[model samples]
Target: MRPREASALDALPALPRDDDGPVFAEPWQASAFAMTLALSERGVFSWAEWVDTFSGELKRAAEAGTPDDGSRYYHHWLAALERLIAEKGLADPAILVDARDAWDRAAKATPHGKPIGLSPDDLARIRDAG
Candidate 1:
């Protein structure tokens, strides 16, 4: 994935939650969703094309007896993203690997304990500085 895509995915948990719950209840789903949006926004594919591809993938998965649970759905999304990236020559696999590693490190460094030490904005600035 591109760095912006990864960052977008990483930001999902911090976004205000929708009534259905969090917009992304799972990490992989967030990643997949961000990737789809990023690719579409970048003009690599149209939104209609993305919907069609997702529908096709869902149908194939159903035929294989795997219903469209979130994880499987995201897996399909990731596969589609990978295919598009490859077809468009957007970035090589090595770049994606590096991006993933950077994202993972950032995710890990995020505070998980009780809020302390600073206001949210201040903490964010501190993290950004680091």
Candidate 2:
């Protein structure tokens, strides 16, 4: 990883990191972490901007009476990322919502341990809705 990406990892202090790497409770959590670094490195947003957004997210959850436990930290991270992506106009928010719903449907339909795959029809539905 580049120096900037390495610094991005510092933004995630809640996650347990060792010489190997940061540990995640789930695969999707790691995927979200990777996406944040990739987008930051691509100039989608500055690391400082991410810190502000993520900080606000954490504060919001606390104000809403959510526990400070680390279990939901990644959910807030994802919310911050989605907010930033929309705020930056990098992607259409409606398209993102549509894609998320499609994925929800696909995941719901898939059996446990099976890789969730979106059918062509699902893409067509998402595109049409978007």
Candidate 3:
């Protein structure tokens, strides 16, 4: 693993990994992981803060009756990343909500097996390049 990823994993001991590196079951999971690492590297939030927020998310999920069977690790990860982004004012929380809603609308509009395409206006509302 690269030095940064190694350091990230060191700080995130809960992360699932193997001999190669962190294991992600989905592409979006990897995106969420990378985005968190990038944000931390840029000093948007300290890794300690990330850990605390992520731990809180996991705790919340468990309290809500979700089991920590590793199936939803990335779900908590993404939730934590979203909370941090909103807490830091990097992006408006409403924009994220709107984006999610827009994606749902677009997906419902799209036919089966084809790509889900959002409207230009919805796409324009996206602030992050990622």
Candidate 4:
């Protein structure tokens, strides 16, 4: 791993890590983890900012009676990322919402076990909405 990535993981004590690296239960979890580190390295937010947002997400999920299973951990991470991005004015919240809807549509349309690629119309719709 790159030094920056190593430092990022080192800073994230709550995250599960081993000699191999941070362990992720699923592909999307890994994507979310990488996105947060990349954004922090770009100076979009501090690692502390991520931790603060993520902690709040975890707390809220717990209060809402969500199970504390490892399965839903990354779901909370993604929520925190979205919240932080919007709160920091890094991206328009509406754009995120539109992109999410577009991706959901694309995923549902794609076949099981096949890669989901967004169609031109999906891109156009998000762009138009923005």
* Candidate 3 stretches greater than 4 Å from native: 1-22, 125-130
Number of the predicted model whose TM-score against the real structure is largest: 2
Regions of candidate 1 where Cα sits further than 4 Å from its true position: 1-19, 69-71, 93-130
Comparing 2 and 3 by TM-score, which wins?
A: 2
lDDT score of residue 42 within candidate 3: 95
lDDT of 4 by residue, 7-108 (tens): 666774374444654588678899999999999999999999899999999999999999776668899999999899889887787788778888898899
- Looking at model 3, residue 103 earns an lDDT score of 94
- Best-to-worst ranking by TM-score: 2, 3, 4, 1
Model 2 misplacement above 4 A: 1-22, 108-113, 124-130
Lowest lDDT 10-mer window, candidate 2?
13-22
lDDT of 3 by residue, 16-57 (tens): 545655577789999999999999999999999999999999
Write out the backbone clash pairs for model 2.
none
TM-score of model 2 vs. true structure? 0.71
Off by over 4 Å in 4: 1-22, 111-114, 124-130
What tens-digit string does per-residue lDDT give for candidate 1 at 35-98? Answer: 7898799888899888877777777777988855454657777777776677678777666665
Tens-place lDDT per residue, model 2, 1-104, is 55654577677647443465458978889889999999999998999999999999999999999876676889999999988988998778778777888899
